[model samples]
Target: MDERLKTNLNLWNAMVPVHVDSKGYRVDKFRSGENHLFPIEREEVGDVRGKSLLHLQCHFGMDTMSWARLGANVTGLDFSEKAIEAACALSAELKIPARFLCSNIYDAPNVLSEKFDVVFTSYGALCWLPDLKKWGAVAAHFVKPGGIFYIAEFHPMTQVMANGGGVAHAGEAKKLELEYSYFSTAMREFPPGPDYSDHSVTLEHGSHEWMYTTAGVVSALLDAGLQIEMLHEHPVCCFQMFPFMVRIEGTRYWRIEGDPIPLTLSIKARKPL
Candidate 1:
């Protein structure tokens, strides 16, 4: 593994225990038979019953086991060994049939040879990858012919906004300030800060991430020979991305006041038979 990825691996390994205990992951609820997946993904990738599903970049297999709960034969692959260990333990304890593998996304082809009926990845997974072309190829490689490849991810537009760092937040009417370029092809380094799942706990290790525009992401899948089925832009996000964002009435999603821009996107693609 590259030095940057190794650094990220260590960071993620540290996050597993924190996330398992965090309210954001709701591990206890999950153990008591709650599905962690949001309605958007469940509705978009409908009826996983009796299908083979492969979840890439699956941190501790919460979503992966959720699919298993829905009757999909599920396999989750992550780079962090700690996460995989936790996932296996959870699967055994809950009696949810699942296979968890530990391997970086780029090297997944060597670790797993079988193809899946659905290749799925979502939320906060894309930024960790430095190369989308290779990521696309790996996704394509895992999907059987005519199978589906789906992703529900944070929009690239959201990454450009200033989260903190001296930016003013004017209640509900806060203006979005651009902190990073959407077109730049550079790796970003973040300093040690609060964990996204639990703001009370701080992460000691900083990590590197890469950004990809919607166009860049779409192009990679097209180049990998997958046919684009649909690309949907959503005005709401699964979490509070900005300080001024408001949560919707009965949902786990948050939205900017007046809904000025897209906060998340989901794409459905199919491999050629």
Candidate 2:
């Protein structure tokens, strides 16, 4: 692993327990049969019953096990060993039959040989990967011929604005101020701190992340021989990505009330038979 990735792995390992206990992850509700998946993903990746599903960067396997609950044979993979162990424990305790793997996404092919009917990942996943082309190939590789790969993630544009820029803190007007580039040549590195899931835990190591343009992500998948099926951008995100955003009443969606920009993006691509 690259040194940066190792540091990220350590950060993620530290996050497992914190995330498991966090109310946002809904570990308790998940145990009570609530699916952790958002509506966009559930609807876009529709009816996974009886399908073989592979979830990459599946933190603690909540979504992976949710797919299993819907009748898909599921396998969840993450670079964090602690996360995978926790996932395995959850699977056993709930009797939700699912497989969990502790391997970096790039090395996944070397550890697991099976292709699946669906290859899935979501939310905060792509940024952790330093190389989008390699990540694309890994995604395309696991998707069986004719199978689909799906992702619902924060928009790249949002990342550009969200990267220490344009954030309206609490009690301030929500407005976008572009502080980061849409096409930067370098990866952004930051001192490790509280992550989105849990704010209580802090890490000792620095973190690394890369932002990808919408075109860049789409092109990589195309180059990997996956046909783009659907690409959708939504104005509301599943979480309050911006500090000043508010959750829409009676919905799991959040947005800056009057200031709307694309906050989330979803794509579905299919491998040809």
Candidate 3:
């Protein structure tokens, strides 16, 4: 693994236990038969009953097992050994019948040769990848002919704005600022900070991330020969991306007060039959 990816792997490995115990992941609720998946992905991916599905960057397999709950033969892959171990343990405990693999996404082809009926990945997944072209190819490689390739991810547009940008906080509103360039290919490093799932816990490891445009992501899949089906921009996101965002009642999703901008993007593409 590249040094940057290795660094990220360490960070993710540390995050596994934190996230598993965090309320955000809802591991307890999942144990009680609640589906951890958001409506956007469940609706878009549709029925997976009896289909083989591969989930990339699957952290501890909550979402992957959620698919298995819906009757998909699910397999999850992540680079973090701790994460894979947690996922396997959870699957065994629940008797969910899942296969969890520990390997970098780019190296998936070498370790696993089976094609699937669906290739799935979601939220906060793309930013971890340093190269979209190779990532797209890897995703396409596992997708059988006529199989679906689906992603519901954070919109790149949201990445340009500063965190809490343009959102009201403590009776004050701030205009959104472009804190990061939208088109830069440079790798960005982040210092250790509050874990996303558990804000009370500070991560011991820093990590690296990359920025990608919507066009760049779509083009990558197109270049890999997946036919574009539909791309949907959503005003609501699975988590609170901005500090001032409000959570939708009865759902895990959050959104800006007036829903001014797209927070999530979902795409469904298919390999040629």
lDDT of 1 by residue, 1-273 (tens): 999998898899889999999888889999899999988899999999999999999999999999999999999999999999999999999999999999999999999999999999999999999999999999999999999999999988988877632112223436687888889879998877777887777788889999999999999999999999989999999887787788899998988889988998999999999
Q: What is the lDDT of candidate 1?
A: 0.90
- TM-score attained by model 3: 0.96
State in Å the error of residue 134, model 2.
1.0
Q: What TM-score do all the candidates reach, one by one?
A: 0.96, 0.94, 0.96
Candidate 2 or 1, higher TM-score? 1
Off by over 4 Å in 2: 162-173
Query: What lDDT score belongs to each candidate, Candidate 1 first?
Result: 0.90, 0.87, 0.90
TM-score, cand. 2: 0.94
Instruction: Please state the error at residue 229 of candidate 1 in Å.
Output: 0.3
Comparing 1 and 2 by lDDT, which wins? 1
**What's the C-alpha lDDT at position 5 in model 3?**
93
Residue 254's C-alpha lDDT in candidate 3? 90
